[model samples]
Target chain A: MSAAKKTALCAMLCAVSAVLSTLESALPLPVFFVPGCRLGLSNLAVITAIPLVGAAGSLSVVAVKSLLILVTRGVTAGIMSISGGLLSLAVMLLLFRLARFGFVGVSVASAAAHNTAQLAAAGLLMGDVRVFSFWWLYLLLSIAAGALTGVAAGVIIPPLGRALGAR
Target chain B: MKKLSKTPLFAAADIFIIALVLALAAVPFFISVKGAGAPLSASVKINGRDAGSYPLDNAGEFKLVGENGIEMTLVVDGDGVFVKDSSCRDKICERTGKITREGQSVICMPGRISIALEGETGGADAVVG
Candidate 1:
């Protein structure tokens, strides 16, 4: 892809991801077990972009999405989003580039990284490692949720990549 | 980057991760669930500080004032403890419903208040901090 085309694709993926993030946050999750847990549908764009546009493209998508969230939500939410977003993006890149994990593997790795990053951010804000102990259930929940979302990302990425000519 | 391929949805590696997740999920249940007759309690905290502790069996209502002068009304009954009302705009904590199981929690982010179940089985006490 030409430089201009690559930038355009990144822009489109960023917009799609931003919309997904906002829409997911607005909806009432039916998950009773983990109150604040989400499906992380926005990751579809990042996962799709990674194979096509590469690691830098994925980071740009996350950056734009988090910026949109910061503008719409608040500073604290923005901070949390960036922390989780950057960590997960890096993990996905590493898994994809080094581990030769398929789309599903990368998706699951990123999802777990996202949740762990959020937990670390929360722990830092509260100045207590015990914050993690109190929320240990979320660790298990993250794995299950990650797998489910990973599958969703795996299913969606192929067609989306075809449209973008990234795959 | 490698070209994408159309592999089976549930690849062998995917199934492996799924099985690993299932095994991890079961550990928490086994570790937390034991001796049902044990009494249950709830710990209340505000801004990571201990607010108070109340037994789930007790039937009563009380008010918790948080750091920012935020107020939350906690009601406890046979079912469990819950937030009946809160000064926060969203009222998510109030809508979380009663938490009866061990390790369950009702958290009000805006108010910085958290109420978590305390099991008499000597499971670690729940605290926001």
Candidate 2:
């Protein structure tokens, strides 16, 4: 309810999201598919923060989580991770502003944006535009995964928001 | 907010797309194996002296020798190339299995090592770059 309470709650959410992301990073995927390519469980915090604390708060949470990861993981992977986070946050904020499609829509958009950003980064890093040939496949995958995680976040966050009381 | 319900349409779409990807991934396996490209043999020279040669075999195995008499085996498969056996921590190179496509690479940061596949495209419908 109070501004102070909201700030504190945002901070806590960011911390939780960082921890979730770190854990997700440890899970192994196939060798061809890049690891840490998943829209982390911590993104739930970002989705929740969007509606509860507004765009600024949501962006803050994303920035904090990315910064924490960057510091811990070092620069090589951190650069791409941060880029993806920023892109996801931007997409979620845009969707939240444009349509009242609720959390599901925002989550899907964020997920799609996240994948797009990563693929874009990969293309640039590898010095081959064909890298984006895989974008369509990854985009589809991100939407599915993003929707699943977004829905879960939508259900869980309101209560947590209430318990934490308007932060 | 309305209670979220699972939509059959979404599920159907998911299955269709997944099947499509599986099909795409499998095409390479079924196609006839073209003769292996110019065996990736080259005397890896750092400055002038020989570092080693990556004798690319049709069976997809190569030998990597370092300046200090260290030797490693690199294996390439349908999936990608990886250091089958290496005396390096982080096993990053080992984990980066054979890369058959252009722009894909496996880097061993500690060993200052890199194994990459260049000028080759994925086994999909030939969409030339």
Candidate 3:
């Protein structure tokens, strides 16, 4: 793919991810373990974009997604989103490129890392370590949600890759 | 690249990761559950500093103020302690429902108040990794 096309595709991915994020938040999941936890459906696009547009393009998608959240929400929300997004993308890139792991492993690891990053950011901002106390439950939820998202991505990515002509 | 007959949903690495995460998630629960019968004590902290603590055995209410001046009313009634009310925008702490067991907590993020039950099996056990 040409550079211009990759940029346009990444832009399209950002828009799709932002929409997914917004839509997923509206979902009334039967989750009571962690109050603010979601299924991480928005990560589907990020997982798909990695192999399609490479790390740089995926990073742009993350940046655009964070920017969208920053504009709509406040600064703290923006910070959390960016921290989670970037950290997760880094993990995904490493696992996908170096380890040659399938989409499932990469996406699941990325989701878990994203949650950890968000928790770390919140703890630092609040100057509290008690936040870590909830690690057990949050980690479990993140992994479980990550697995679900990873499976969904695995099911969709092969076909989507063929459709988009992505490696 | 070697063409595989099928795209396996879970590779060996994926199973290993899943097992690792499950083990990590289970460790705390197992440790905490061992002391489930321990007495319930409310440990209150404001702005991450130790504010005070009260035994849930005696039912009463106490108001705590965060550094940001957010007011939180903690009520300990028959059964357990819970956040009766909070001044924060979202009543998440209030809606956290009643926390009766050990290691349970009601944290008001925006209010910067943490009300956790001091469990006997605790003492940096949950913070290991």
Report lDDT (CA) for all predictions: 0.71, 0.58, 0.75
The CAPRI-style docking tier of model 2 reads: incorrect
The best candidate in terms of lDDT: 3
Q: What is the DockQ (computed on Cα atoms) for candidate 1?
A: 0.26
Angstrom error of the Cα, residue A118, model 3: value is 2.1
Location of the lowest summed lDDT over 10 successive residues in candidate 1 chain A: A126-135
> What ranking of all candidate models by DockQ puts the best one first?
3, 1, 2
Q: Which ten residues in a row have the lowest lDDT in candidate 3 chain B?
A: B1-10
Q: Which ranges of candidate 1 are over 4 A from the true structure? A: A31-33, A98-100, A127-152, B6-10, B33-38, B67-70, B89-91, B119-129
Task: Give the number of the best model, judged by TM-score.
Answer: 3
The candidate with the higher lDDT, 1 or 3, is 3
Instruction: Assess the local accuracy of residue B106 in candidate 3 as a C-alpha lDDT between 0 and 100.
Output: 79
Structure candidate 1, residue pairs in collision: none
Q: Write the per-residue lDDT of candidate 2 for residues B12-128, one digit (tens) a residue.
A: 233443444446545544432433442343223322333544433434666776433435677755544567777753455565445564434554333334454443322334434
lDDT of 2 by residue, A1-167 (tens): 68897888778878888878878777554532542356457788887777677778888888888788678865545666777889989876765565445565566667767766765665555443434434555566665676688678767866765676552
Global lDDT for candidate 1? 0.71
TM-score of each model, paired residue for residue: 0.79, 0.63, 0.84
lDDT of 1 by residue, B1-129 (tens): 666664334456655554554565466566655535458878877777777888877789989876456788899898788887688655666766787876677776545666777776566444433
